[model samples]
Target: MKKISLILSLIFLSIGLLGCQQSGKEEELNKEISKSTQEITDKPTIIGEIVQIEGERFLVENKTEKLPDGRPDAVWFSTDEMESLKVGLIVSVWTNAIEDSYPQQANAKKIEINEY
Candidate 1:
């Protein structure tokens, strides 16, 4: 009986941890939605000025976008994850749109820099 109780307790603990992780993911999803709705009202201002102009990958501070059409608010980019990035450039990004990675940063799958 004791052994059975121990096993049950461990299972419960694992389930609780998984629950917490799922909640975090939900929060991130909420943020993405809010950003998109806000964009229509707030307007992120994508003026193309976005400087730094590096090798394809670029950084943006006040970037607000939709997650995906017919879903929620803003779409999250996989490339947005990287810290070191500049502005004024083109790049391809891969997405891991799941519950683990929150705020949805980019992966930078491809990059195309401006001519210097």
Candidate 2:
């Protein structure tokens, strides 16, 4: 009958609309996941020697990278394992964020001592 056909059409339309909305949500979620993956993949690692230690913060010096002022590139980082670190030790530091400054500053998310 015509009434049955109308009801069926409405149901199909509703399902189609719901499916479209669901796909939109899935697309948004996929974009967010891709962005997060890119951030983690592109995260930088600073490899240098511990030049100075101040409280919970330490300065890492990379002699190969130089500044316009002709000094070695250095960055100050705050770490939870300062007690385990010492001067003259080469370290690899993974950071979540870095602040722009004369001597860059960052918080170490991970640190590894590299032995020669």
Candidate 3:
């Protein structure tokens, strides 16, 4: 009877340890998911001078930040807003991420010209 009880106790302890480890992994996954969600929600609004404008797409030199590679951060904008844009113009652009692209492109939702 004592041997049976010992085996049962070991089995229960093993299950408990497994459950704790699984819960720890789940919590870590949840934290990662939360961080990603926050990043998506916190997309930065870019304020920059228009460097180039080609048809419906334009490139802006972001004065407020730099890219990870130490290049002056440049954002690409695609919108009807191009009608009012000119090279050297300072503007604020509201944007959203383009899915599945390297150096990520943004779709400009609105553009407001800032008076110098």
Best by lDDT: 2
Residues 26-111 of candidate 2 have per-residue lDDT tens digits of 99999888754444224446789999999999999987888888988888999788888999999888875678896899888788
User: 1-116, model 1: which lDDT tens digit per residue?
Assistant: 99999999999999999999999999999999875444221222221223343443343322344345432222233343345445544333323322333332443333333343
lDDT by residue (tens digit), candidate 3, 41-87: 34346788998888898887887688787877677878875667899
For all predicted structures, in order, the TM-scores are 0.35, 0.61, 0.55
Worst 10 residues of 2 by lDDT: 35-44
lDDT at 60, model 3:
77
Ranking by TM-score: 2, 3, 1
For all candidates in order, the CA lDDT equals: 0.44, 0.85, 0.77
For all the candidates, what are their Cα RMSDs to the real structure? Answer: 13.1, 5.3, 6.8
- Prediction 1 global C-alpha lDDT: 0.44
Clashing pairs in 3: none
State each candidate's clash count.
15, 0, 0
